[model samples]
Target: MKRESRQTTGGQAWVVNRKKEDKKMEPKWLTERRQKAAEDFKTLPLPKTDEFWRRTNLSRIPFDQFEPIQSVTNGAAKGSASRYLPVPMMVSGELLYGEKMSPATLDPNSQKAGVILDGLQNALEKYPELVLKYFGKGFQNRHEKFLAQNEAFWQTGVFCYIPKNTQVELPILLASHFSGGNQSAAPRLLIVLDKGAKTTIVHYASSETENDSIFLNNVVEIYIEEEAHLTYIDSQALSDQTFEIAQKRIELETNAKLKWVLDIQGSKLSKTNIETVLKGSGAAAEVLGLLCGNKKQHLELYAWTQHAAPHTTADILIKGTANDAAKTIFQGMIRIEKAAQGTESYMANNNLVLSEKAHADSIPRLEIEADDVRASHGATIGQVDAEQLFYLETRGLNREEAEHLIVEGFYEDIFGRIPVESVREVMRKNIEKKVGVIA
Candidate 1:
């Protein structure tokens, strides 16, 4: 594949110049969808002017310099997959993606239950109808530039489907590890749980090294049918020189339940948006986020929970800590529609500024249209408490140790909410490394 030079006009010439042989092989509907997104990407402006993007600037990024990955290739080393797997032995299925996605490994029971877990390209070839039925159906942001770009140029993806009334006893793991610099990748993921299904999924994304400069724009869509349950853990620990923009959309039907955990600890600049919509009565969602930023890193997150039906409920809590000259931003919103009577929603964001040069921002909002709904929001931005530090120091701990203990305490609440012990441990270790508690 040939790399195209940056164009001053919209920086989208590369899309037109990309190879079309692979596109020609894809289904007509899929090809047409990509074509529409390509056109949309050419016209949609960078989201810097939007209110949600006002806190973070996208103008500084060299959008045209990075070469887009053209195809799926094994970007990671052989026999090195264990590093990316959260629990190698415990998972019922595993899919690893470098530039190319590996064949999924599933247990016999899961396969016999009609579960489908495979690379998106393979899934499209083998089960086009299933892929077409749910692909891009839950995404509500039609005009976002990055979302459109992913839709147009995504080279690798994971597709997982749990059949109706089937329950997977173990979690499934999807891991992506990019290995090069000066490259960009668009990876998409689709997960569908039919009615009365139950499962847990762990999605992890990272770069091979801590210093590789890359750009990653990814999208994930999830659908939970009536009475289905899903526990999703999404974690990102990319290179310090990577710029990542990610969006995850989830839709829940009647009596559906979701527990979502988001852990972000890496990337030079990361902007993530997570939206969950309760479209049926008795649907519920619980979201927990942990962000740790160090050095000159900038991490921003936007979480929105929408209650569109009566008896729906949502709870969101996000905690972050910034060290050195790092910056962190959290924006949360809870919306209750007019027909969502008996809706219960709450959102809270708390931040700890570890150094004077560090910065943190927290914004919480609530929009309630239903008379009987209970919605509230709160936020806090403060430095490490001097009294608490002193108290820990008095217990024979050094200054660094005391600060680490306090930071650990701050994140303990979020960790306790995570159902998977291994995932919690992995996140705890990452947090410790970020806080300089461990090498």
Candidate 2:
């Protein structure tokens, strides 16, 4: 086992101690991969000068002060797994992760349909060949420092597979709960849908402690096969004193369809990347995001959609609101390759600054190589409409109530597009609470 340490300029350092027990539990191939990633993680430097990172100050984060959790014990006995139970709607399956990842439970119908849902470690033991085939296929950038760290240290995660020609009517839930202070966790997720399959998945992450300073690095990979359809919802609500970084990669094949929704609300500082590749003809994708920042929270997101085949299409809409001294940033890009002659894509980001000290930034970019493609990008940043607020105030509402109503109305469009009603309702309530509309 090799131990690596990352030193900060301030003379502080954090060490990652590789456990022999973890290496012994996996096959030789996986062990080799982890070893390679660990080496890469040590050599790869943070992209501080990169365009995506120029706006944020990386040195200010005290990464060296947090201890990386190398192992996890069962959390069920500690009463931490029940936070996500009694979900608002029925689910085909549910996977819970706290200090540890639990065994997945699936409805009989789903299991009978040849669906596979299990903890990532368990899946490696039970379905080694299947997991190995699609393990790292979706990632476009293998050398990224954060990605390398996740690949090297991830110990808790979920693996979900839907067989060909099967349709799971109810959504599946994967929930992760984090607690404690000055601790770091790296969790990974993999979801694969075979040809002509259809399913819906909700990925939710939250923290139980409100003031704990924590660090979370997460990665998710999803593959949609030919003619398959998938709806994925990713929501994050961590503690206000935490630093979170997450990356999600998705690949769609011929005639496949995808609907991706993101709801971000918590974390003292959060940076997320969502990249989708339309690899085959007729593939389509729609991405919708909602960001709500309050207090001193900083939320940032980068969404990229690549049209690599003919007749592929994509649409992205992200709405954000910042209050107090919080800040929000959104960067969106749509790329059409030369082979994607009939591609049609559009990207838009809109933001509202509710307080004088609050700030919001939106960057929309387009790169087109196909002459026949149609692509457009736009962004807008503005404050609440005084006229609308006055109208609401005249209708017997105070200024706070009026602003809350306006914010709600501003996000209604994106909320209406959410495929899961339960998730949409939960996000709505979370936003309401953030806006001080409810206790």
Candidate 3:
């Protein structure tokens, strides 16, 4: 099938169409959704000045020059990733070389209770019914531009579906890299945990080359059924020239639990949103975000947790380190509906400014309509205390070394809560690199 990605004026970024390439043999269901998504991309004006895009400027990016990744249905890409992956993962395979997706089947030793773990193409080929049943179901009401663009032009995706009552003890990992050349990678990931199921996923996205320019538009959807549990960690270390616009939405049923962590360590300009909806009684969620911005980097993160059921609970904590001329924005909100009684929520945002030019903004909000509920929010923006710096320096450390230690202590509370050792190590190393330390 011949396909092409076109860049049009206005809000549309890239449109992938096979109409003139191949239409006669296209499946009816596949063609219709793709056609509708393409139409959405065309009609939906890219939010140039929308409130969502106000904090991070999208006008500077050359969207028309961004190229959509080409899909390769071969084995060479897998071989490349095998040499680069850090054991137990097939990251950066076809997605960067020529293939659009990295597909996998359940590991006999790791997977139990008939769980399904595969890529987008694999699920579409083997489990078409299930894939169609859940795809785009979580965000049917969100009319965001980047979300629609990602749905329309995604070249590859990851799908993890846990069976009812099954528990996966091992942490699943998916690593991906983007090569230089001003290309765009749209990866759509879906995670579904059935009733009483439990699992953890560690996602990684990085740059293949330091000097390369790239744009990443990604979407992730998580569905938690009654009494299920899901822990997800997203780590990004892209090139300094990369532009990223991403969104993650999660839906929780009765007695479900969601633990989410987002670590944004690199990118020239990054804008992301974390949305969680508690639709059933007794559902609970915890959201945490950590970011380190340096050298003119701009990062904006928004989080929203809505409580529509009684006895639901949520907690949010966001921490950041900004140095040089970098800027960071953190916005969090918790909404309790009128019918949701006995709801509990707490939101907090803290930042450490390491330079005089560095800037940070924090906005925490709460909307409560029900009775017998507890909700509170707090935000703080401060720098290293002069007395503490002097105390550390007098103890024999230089300014850089003392500052580094102070920054580490600033994020210790949040870092200690991360369960994965490897993830915490990655975040620590990146922070140390950004903040200077003695060799």
Q: Model 1, range 1-439, lDDT digits (tens) per residue?
A: 1322333223463485455534457887787778788878877777767888888777546677677777674444433444675444378888887575566788999999999987788899999998989999976457778888888788888899999999998888888888766788889999999999999998888885444467888899999999999999998888788888898999999999999999999898999999999999999999999999999999999998899999999999999999899999999888899999999998889999999999999988889899998888899998998898799789888888888888898998998899888888778777777775732
Tens digits of per-residue lDDT, candidate 3, 284-392, equal: 9988889889999999898988999999999888998898999999988788999889999989999988889999988888899998899999999998789998999
Local error of candidate 2 at 287, Å? Answer: 0.2
- Where does model 1 exceed 4 Å of error? 1-13, 21-24, 73-81, 86-89, 209-212
2 against 3, candidate with superior lDDT: 2
After superposition, the stretches of candidate 2 with alpha carbons farther than 4 Å from their true spots are: 1-15, 19-23, 77-82, 85-87
lDDT winner: 1
Candidate models: Cα lDDT each: 0.84, 0.83, 0.76
| TM-score sort, best first | 1, 2, 3
Stretches off by above 4 angstroms in model 3 are 1-13, 16-27, 72-106, 437-439
Q: Candidate 2 has what TM-score?
A: 0.94
In the predicted model 2, the residue pairs found to clash are: none
| RMSD of each predicted structure | 2.9, 3.2, 4.2
- Residue-by-residue lDDT tens digits, candidate 2, 1-439: 1112344221122223555545456788887777777777777777678998767666656677676765553445322333563347567788787456666778899899999987787889899999999998876356887888788777678889999999999988888877776778788899999999999998878875554577788899999999999999888877788788888999999999999999899888898989999999999999999999999988999998999999999999999999999999999888899999999999989999998999999988999999998888899999988888799889888888888888898899998898777888778878877885732
Count of clashes, each model: 0, 0, 3
